[model samples]
Target: MANQAAPVRSFLQAAAKTEEAPLPLRVVQIEGLAILKIIKHCKECSPDPVTGQLLGLDVGSVLEVTNCFPFPTRDEDEELEAEGANYQLEMMRCLREVNVDNNTVGWYQSTFLWSYQTEDLIETFMNYQENIRRCVCIIYDPSKSNQGVLALKALKLSDSFMELYRNNNFTGEKLREKNFTWVDIFEEIPIKVSNSPLISCVMTQLETDSPVNQCDYDRLQLSSTPYLERNLEFLVGCMDALSKEQQELQFHYRILARQQAQQQAWLQKRRAENMARKAAGEEPLPEEDPSNPIFKQNPEPSRLNSFLITNQIANHCNQINGAVGQNFSRLYLTKALHEN
Candidate 1:
């Protein structure tokens, strides 16, 4: 993987030179069947995060995701890790033999309540980005999809964060210099579902043969108390986690400040002792700076987790608000009918 990164970087550089301007990646085109497969896979792995590889090509700035396959859910064992890699390799080999898009464009994973951002996820994205410059992570929220709407997102690690992450420098000064924020870490790429004419025709025929039932609309209008209750619970949990992380960060800052003050005081004492030796006409001791190589700088604590927790809380709030609005509308309708 390390060796492969150079060629990928070289290719991107050459590609950039040929273009009039650096073409910003804009669209993620996924086949309708591919989307169905992703949704099905997510449903099967409900309550657990499921991941798979994406196969496609990059044409200009548009990424066409033609196919995907789910990875088996296995525990973190060395044997399983080896098997997973082999499985992916063999799968890509078979796709190539069939003249399909065998290139590894990115990968997809199922997330619950927007809990997709984490250190593990960041590391995975970084690995993919190293191998494929335009690699993205497709997040599918099955919980949301079950609520009559599909929730899919295409996200790529932002270039600024990528550089910072590569250097393994999350120092406070560096973060402040970059003006880094939670939102800036991952850039969401717009996605559009696509289908061929033949596929579209087949769908139309199927729709005619098995028309959607009107009763489904009535069921959709019914309030889902369990869903609402679960969402609120999740929201509260996220808020608690967010608050705890904030406190931890504040405590870390105080500790860091105290350490700095102690170092300064020690340095001052050493300087005074050296001055006294000079006054006594004795050989001055070698000056020692407390801020030397021996005192390694503390790596800034990661705020990525806190930021992600905050984002999840926001999503939960939005969901709760939508549910409440629907309930109020139903209540108002019921009252009006009773009056009539």
Candidate 2:
């Protein structure tokens, strides 16, 4: 165990030094087969969020994800939890015996309509970060893929926010001191899908054997109204949820302000009474501390949900714009042909 720990410690030290430099870790390489497997798993679990474990090695600043396996749906039973843990351990052991990249670098999950940003995801990333210094969460959007584009993103908790999270401090003052915001909590790393020469050659042969080409752009259909409508609906839903959360936060702040004002008034009254007692040639009543049970602190509400809703709304808007633009272009082309 010491022998293995030495290499990991050295690697972490090197990574820390690299982080200190101006250069940033921006690139993540995923095997072509791994991507395909992820997509397949997501499709199979369509509409429901699916999770998987990523096995890979970190080479300098690049994270190479070589393999993955899907996890079954989690139940609220303790027996199931134990079974799941044992299963994962046995699987990792088997991979090690087979000389595969058994190191758990991170995890992946499927998202619908960019709804991957949530408190659950944040907690999961925090747990992984605590165990591994440089852990990431990969989000795969099958909804986007249905529109002919594959969407895969790698996200990690930012260093500053991770420290705050580790200490379990989300106070307004602490957040302000660290300059933390929803956008800064998760940093998205760029991803590149790579295939070996042999794999490329095999793909070429398979393409040649296909009777019909799937890339016939000339015969492509231009109807995207369904996609546009879906995106617009999602956007509206997100906006509504965001507005409600904002109102709730505003209400909380108002209540807090009112409570503080009342507390101050009570303190002033107590001081006045104490002054009268002192002037009357008697011992002033013992001063009461505001920290007493009467002044209970209100726990600050989490803004994570609001931030996630805003992000989802933004993504929906972008998708809607792109779909609209494509429709407009198609219309203009059709009109020009008719005029000509």
- Every candidate's lDDT: 0.82, 0.80
Model 2 TM-score is 0.83
Tell me the lDDT of candidate 2.
Answer: 0.80
Q: Candidate 1 — which pairs collide?
A: none
* Residue lDDT tens for model 1, 113-205: 677767899899887766776778899998776666668999988889888888876666788898987677888999999999999998877
Report lDDT (Cα) of residue 219, candidate 1: 32
The candidate that wins on lDDT is: 1
lDDT of 2 by residue, 131-157 (tens): 775777889988777665677899888
Hey, what RMSD does candidate 2 come out at?
5.5
Which sections of candidate 2 miss by over 4 Å?
A: 1-24, 73-78, 209-220, 291-294, 337-340
Worst 10 residues of 2 by lDDT: 212-221
TM-score of structure candidate 1? 0.83
